[model samples]
Target: MPKISNQNLFDALLDSWDRNNTILVNLLQAFSHGGLEIRAMEGGPSIAELFTHMHYCRLIFVLEDAPECARPINRQEWASEQDPSVLARLLNESAAAVREAVKSRVEAGQDMLVHYDHPILMLQHMIWHEGYHHGQIKLALKLAGRPFSDDEAGLITWDVWMNKT
Candidate 1:
């Protein structure tokens, strides 16, 4: 097997992050189109709850210290009393922070570490976390009898987005 260079790995990480963001944008767009409701599930969170949870995860992996980041928070607490517009603003801010952190890491030539719990790993986790919750949100929508648009799924696979250009 060919060895992958640090730059290549970093590029792949960024691609994953970009694809996640694309899916998030699609989900949010669908949610904004109305018909979506905030409702509790038997053992899962509602769509609103999941959105806030995603924001909290972003803060955890991207902003908090390694030790503090390891601790978990109540998704209900994070989701409660949140104004939709405020949530949107915070989400955008979190996305910007992730982008800046990735850029800084790449510029510093410090992306070659093979074993370390660093910002890069946190960023990578954020991508997967977002994608995972995105799937849950779609399922929640389906359960609520709301339409699940193709937007989010269409953005998950990198090749699909690239082929459009």
Candidate 2:
């Protein structure tokens, strides 16, 4: 891809969030309400917790570093919703808030607490952070005995998140 604008980069990160979130939703859809809290591993978070963590991280960053742009996110989304689609919608809303936070800082010539001096790096940080947790989520699903495939892996691939002609 040619050099993408910072706005486009944030948009791509949002795309990545949505794509991975769909796979996470698909995995969770296989389980019952109680099943979302299952953790076959001893120490890791449950599927629901991991999903909540994803949104919480986004919420915290906006609250601490970019309060001016925190209005769009609903921070009280730590609890599990019965519908994965509902959870995905809330997560998307949180991500939109974070994106606006980054946009606000960039427009105001302010620095992010994450990547000093460059506001766009906040988007980079979130893209990587969410992807990291998503990998953990994949493992959590596997440990919970959910099957995986290349189709699911494709969700997190950069090419899938990239804009096309």
* Highest-scoring model, lDDT: 2
Task: Look at candidate 1 and tell me the lDDT of residue 114.
Answer: 34
Candidate 2's residue-wise lDDT over 1-165, tens digit each? 568776586566556555654444455545544466666487657667777777777787887788777655445555654456666766767777777887778668888764445766666677678778767766776876774566655543544445373
Return the lDDT, model 2, position 72. 50
True-structure lDDT of candidate 2 = 0.65
Runs in model 2 with CA error above 4 Å?
1-35, 72-78, 113-115, 155-159, 162-165
lDDT by residue (tens digit), candidate 1, 36-64? 34553775666767777787766555444
Q: Model 1, stretches more than 4 Å misplaced?
A: 1-12, 40-43, 65-77, 81-85, 109-118, 149-164
The 10-residue segment of model 2 with minimum total lDDT is 154-163
Candidate maximizing TM-score: 2
lDDT of each: 0.61, 0.65
Give candidate 2's error at residue 49 in angstroms: 0.7
